[model samples]
Target: MANRCLICDKKKQVGVSSRHHRGVAGKQWMKRAQKTKRTFSPNLQWATVDGIRIRVCAKCLKLIKKEQPKGNLPEIASK
Candidate 1:
């Protein structure tokens, strides 16, 4: 499977770790995403099985919502 999402081409994303401090100095590794995960990707990649062109972020699969409805119309127009 492709690491990047078919929509937005957000790349080079860094994951941060969150930990609670117990007065003493402490650090925790929050399993940051691999560098390879944040790589090159197409800006407008089409969706699978539906062909919905979208802009998404890799690994996160984020989509840019478009408030417009555009698609093919039926041969027979409904009244």
Candidate 2:
């Protein structure tokens, strides 16, 4: 399965990772910490909406749950 949110099309994003304690205590290091390439993946999970399974991100899942009680899931899930 593709690692993407079906609702909003959220996917992994390219970013940089670095050590947080490199310049702590006002001590300047001779060489700065190198940044490494990384990917920030969205929080995705499988969900069943209107009898169909789909992958959705955490934020969209929250919205779906919120609207479920109002019987408006089909409208949002279809998007």
Candidate 3:
């Protein structure tokens, strides 16, 4: 299983967490803050599209359901 969304092409992103503290040693300066690495992963789910099962994000799934035409209508062909 990959950490990517099939429909929206979503992927993991890198982030940082910084720590803040008060001044020390009676000086009006703060110590160097620490940074922690973090990853933001997308919410993905398994869904079937055009008879194919693949991973898609929640937003895309919602859009697909909303945009699908009602009743059994053939898709329009564009040149």
Candidate 4:
């Protein structure tokens, strides 16, 4: 399956991870701070919509569950 949400089209996002350390003198260690590239992937899961199984993000799944009335599933429009 694709790493994308069928409902909202949420996908992987690029970001940065920063690590900072303090010096022995209790001062800011600028050289010791490092930044690394990272990726933020969506929390995708399998869900059945209209009898079709597809992957959706957690956020969209929450909305879908919230909009559902009792045991009846609502029609979710895909993007």
TM-score of each: 0.29, 0.78, 0.64, 0.74
TM-score of 2: 0.78
Which residue pairs in candidate 2 collide?
A: none
Candidate 1 C-alpha RMSD relative to the actual structure: 11.4
Candidate 2: residue 40 lDDT (0-100): 98
Give the number of the best model, judged by lDDT: 2
Worst 10 residues of 1 by lDDT: 70-79
Measured on C-alpha atoms, candidate 2 has an lDDT of 0.82
Off by over 4 Å in 2: 21-29, 74-79
- Higher-TM-score candidate of 1 and 2: 2
- lDDT, candidate 4, 1-79, per-residue tens: 6799877778999999997666656555645778899999999988866678878899888877776656555455554
Candidate closest to the true structure, highest TM-score: 2
Give lDDT tens digits, candidate 3, residues 1-59: 77887666788999997888766777645576778999988888787666767777788
Task: Flag regions of model 1 displaced more than 4 Å.
Answer: 24-69, 72-79
Task: Give Cα-based local distance difference scores for all models.
Answer: 0.36, 0.82, 0.70, 0.77
Model 1 TM-score (2 dp): 0.29
Ranked by TM-score from best down, the candidates are 2, 4, 3, 1
RMSD of each: 11.4, 3.3, 5.5, 3.0
- Sort every candidate by lDDT, greatest first: 2, 4, 3, 1
Per-residue error at 51 for model 1, in Å? Answer: 5.5
